[model samples]
Target: MLTPVLIVLGSYFIGGVPVAYLTGWLLRGVDIRRYGSGNVGASNVWQSISRAAVVPVGLAEIGQGLLGIVIAKAVDQGLAVQVLAGLAALAGHNWSPFLRLTGGRGVGHAIGFLLILSWPGLGAFVGLSLLGVALRAIPQFVGLGIAVAPLAALAKGQSLEIVAGSAGMAALIIAKRLLGNRLALPPGADPRRVLLNRLLYDRDTHEREAWVRRGQDE
Candidate 1:
């Protein structure tokens, strides 16, 4: 019991390392959130810092998720305990205490957790992701693909723990897509338009360039 609890707590802290923040500060001497869609994730790192920064930030975050799963597995805990550790890691990445409860969208972290549990889950993820790209790269559908991985896990007879953990990651991704960084609309900007852009375009309709943060092909 104590071991599981410690795993959860330790994983949470590991998940909250603020990789993007440090990466940006070290490379450009600026708060990543201040520019490039104001996101504290790999996407923003690519925008404000360098194209190369994205991979490292993503790897660090994914490693955080994997760290939690490894700890759980090391304790020889059952599926339930392992799932809890994974979720704790995701929550920490999504709402990192070090980043004032602001963090990445959890896409990489989700990938890490699912990949560790079941590679087939990633097959669902990739197939859907490629389909979305083939259809002209619609942001909404691409993001919706996240939900498919968990369902695939469930259909494949994975344990409840695996299914729930995948589902949790899907939820975090969808939620992030819907409600991105703190709402800082320019005066007179229609909330409805902003919501549409966030949900569909993955950027502020008004300030697409800043949101793209050098990541998009713009």
Candidate 2:
């Protein structure tokens, strides 16, 4: 219906706002996309900018996703709004016009979408994501956690639209990373190093975080 279309489109535009890019530019006068991981997401902002600002940035993105769900709920009762919003947020995070189209991996944005679509779904995603990051915070697990969203939805009796939409968003996340010129490890790269990078990603200092970014940038 027109409602779904409009909700999705609205979510896309809202998600497309590029809070990180705008925030960094306003606060630091530098486009964060050019400084670290070439991403305009919260993680990059945390690395190159002030860590205190990450919460506000993440909250703003989450708010955008919640807004999408509200619009969708007004129209109908399925996962249509949530799913579309998730995808739109993903699209926005990856191809934000504000950042000259350069942006981050959209993990947070995707999480934002799920949080609004289904709280249970959001819980599942958060637990899995944190577990993955705790054990090994590889970007791949972030993608994998996204892939888990549909399954989580199923566990909660969610509709096909939600399932497929969430899965598609996950796929988009993987595709974005691969297409964005991020480094793919050589077949022979040390497994320990890979694991270490994943586990340590969430806690490294700004200066040392650059090491992780270098691996991704290469």
Candidate 3:
């Protein structure tokens, strides 16, 4: 029990190392938070720095999870250790340390977790990722794949660890796409874009819906 708690906290601290922030600052002398997607994740690091920087950024994401497993295994190796490690990895990705306590959306880190914790879940993740890419190519279905993945996992009778991890991953992905509802041209914002962002990013979905209703009534 104590081991699991430590794994979660330690993984978060490790995850919070903010490799992307350091890389962006060293190469470009710019905070990644100020540019592109305003995220201290690998994608923003890649955007702020050179394209080649993604290599290290990607490694950092994977390393966080690897570190978690190492810590967990030092105490014990079982399903609980893996689950706790995955959760820690996600927390670290979202709330990193070196960059004023901020970070990315955790997909890279989540992928690392799945690879170590459950190969079958990793397989499902890969399939969903491919389908997501294809569905998003149409632009309209940009985030539908995220919602679809959990349903697929539920149908498969996935283990609780995999299901919870998948749900967490799905939530992060959907929330991320929602926050990035930027407009290339701004005569007027696209309603579909606005609605999708609202639906996906709304942490309190019912509340957001109620707010929308009030505005519509007014």
TM-score of each: 0.88, 0.76, 0.70
Cα RMSD of all models vs. native, in order, equals: 3.0, 5.4, 8.5
The lDDT ranking, best first, is 1, 2, 3
Candidate 1 lDDT, 96-215, residue by residue in tens: 899888877776777778778967688888787778778866465657667788888988998887888888878877677667767577568788887778777767674566556543
| Residues 1-218 of candidate 2: C-alpha lDDT, one tens digit per residue | 65677777777778889888888889888767566565677877787767889999988877765677767676764566566766886787787765556666777777777776656567777777788778765554565666777788888887788777777877776666655524354357664564454333421222355543543343
Candidate 1, residue 148: the lDDT equals 82
- Displacement of residue 44 (Cα, Å) in model 3 is 2.2
C-alpha RMSD of candidate 1: 3.0
Q: Give the clashing pairs for model 2.
A: 137-198
Pairwise TM-score winner, candidates 1 and 3: 1
Clashing pairs in 3: 16-96, 16-97
Model 3 scores a TM of 0.70
Off by over 4 Å in 3: 128-157, 176-218
Write down the lDDT of every candidate, Cα atoms only.
0.77, 0.68, 0.62
* Most TM-score-accurate candidate: 1
lDDT of 3 by residue, 1-218 (tens): 54677777877788767777788779878766655545567766655566898987888787886678766776676666666776677676676655544577666776677677556556666676676567643222324444554555667786776677667766765564455323242237565766554455432132333422321232
**On TM-score, who's better, 2 or 3?**
2
- Model 1 spans > 4 angstroms off: 133-138, 213-218
Residue 64's lDDT in candidate 1:
85
